[model samples]
Target chain A: GESVGLHLPTLSVQEGDNSIINCAYSNSASDYFIWYKQESGKGPQFIIDIRSNMDKRQGQRVTVLLNKTVKHLSLQIAATQPGDSAVYFCAERGAGAQKLVFGQGTRLTINP
Target chain B: NAGVTQTPKFRILKIGQSMTLQCAQDMNHNYMYWYRQDPGMGLKLIYYSVGAGITDKGEVPNGYNVSRSTTEDFPLRLELAAPSQTSVYFCASSRGQPISYEQYFGPGTRLTVT
Candidate 1:
């Protein structure tokens, strides 16, 4: 079975600081990976995604890094804002449109 | 498009009771899914459908059931609700098929079972 996991349980960073959340997946067959931001009392929102062929991908203020060799993925937010505070999750899809295995999640808090 | 929409923003169930979580999408997506979120555990796939008349169990399908009667709707049913079934539920939809599909989520439904 494919599983996604996060390295940190919680992280607090001062406003305007960069925040990096790490994720590790066990499924090497997974070709697509996504990062989602889930706030309190809300569903997870798509943040960004990376393909196995690509080593990195970037979105609005976010970046997703994929290291196929280590089966690791990460999300980096530049100049993190208060709105960036949420539970960050990493999800992996193994070649079908069926379901995505989600990570345990990392709570990101931006301190002002 | 309104994307994916789920009914009953919140629900409370008693032991041995049953309830259904409704899910609908206007994007004409063929793929739909149900997931449950628990504290620190993230989201676990409960059930999913590829198209109308097609449905399958996911990682944690026990105590839950799902049906896709139309292309736009996929509803999850809880036969006998239990305390362990208490959690936030989310409905998501994707375009589906042989390509890499990105999922859009609904607001969510918070269900509490006692």
Candidate 2:
């Protein structure tokens, strides 16, 4: 079975500071990776995604870096805001897998 | 498009009870899925359907059953609810294969079984 894991369970950062959440996947064949932001009492929202062919991808104020060599993925948030306070999760899908496997998730707290 | 909608936003079931969670999508997507989220745990796939009349079990399909009689609806059935089945359930749909396509999720249905 494939397992996705996050390095940090919780991260606290001051507003306007950069926040990085790390994730590691066990399957090397996993090619598709996605970052999701789940706010309190809501379903997870898609942040961004990267394919194995690409090492990096960026969204409005977020960036996802994929390091297939080390089976690692990271999401970077710029100028974190109070609205960004939520649980972030990284999910991976193997080449021919039917569904994605999600990590435990990292709780991000933004300090005012 | 009302991308994905789930009925019974909140439900409380007693032990040995049976109930169904309803999910409907207007996007006319071919892929639909059901997942459960537990406290401090990631979302676990319960069931998925590639198209109408084609349903399959996912990672955590033990206590659940699903049917995709129509392309727009996929309902999950719990035969005998248990405390372990208490969790938030989400319904999602994608335009294409899940491996390469993005899935849109609904608000979710919070279920509590005692």
DockQ of each: 0.81, 0.79
Model 1: per-residue Cα lDDT over B22-106, one tens digit each: 9999988888999998866789899989999999989899999998999999999999899999998999998875654678999
Most accurate candidate by lDDT: 2
Candidates' TM-scores?
Answer: 0.97, 0.97
User: If you assessed candidate 1 against the hidden native complex, which CAPRI class would it receive?
Assistant: high
Alpha carbon lDDT of each predicted model: 0.90, 0.92
Model 1's TM-score against the true structure: 0.97
Q: Where's the lowest-lDDT run of ten residues in candidate 1 chain B? A: B94-103
- Global CA lDDT computed for model 1: 0.90
Candidate 2 versus the native: TM-score? 0.97
Q: Supply the DockQ value of model 1.
A: 0.81
Give the C-alpha miss distance for residue B66 in model 1, angstroms: 1.0
Candidate 1 C-alpha lDDT tens digits along A35-82: 999988888899998878899998888999999999999999999999
The runs of at least 3 residues in candidate 2 whose Cα sits more than 4 Å from the true structure, single-residue gaps closed, are B98-100
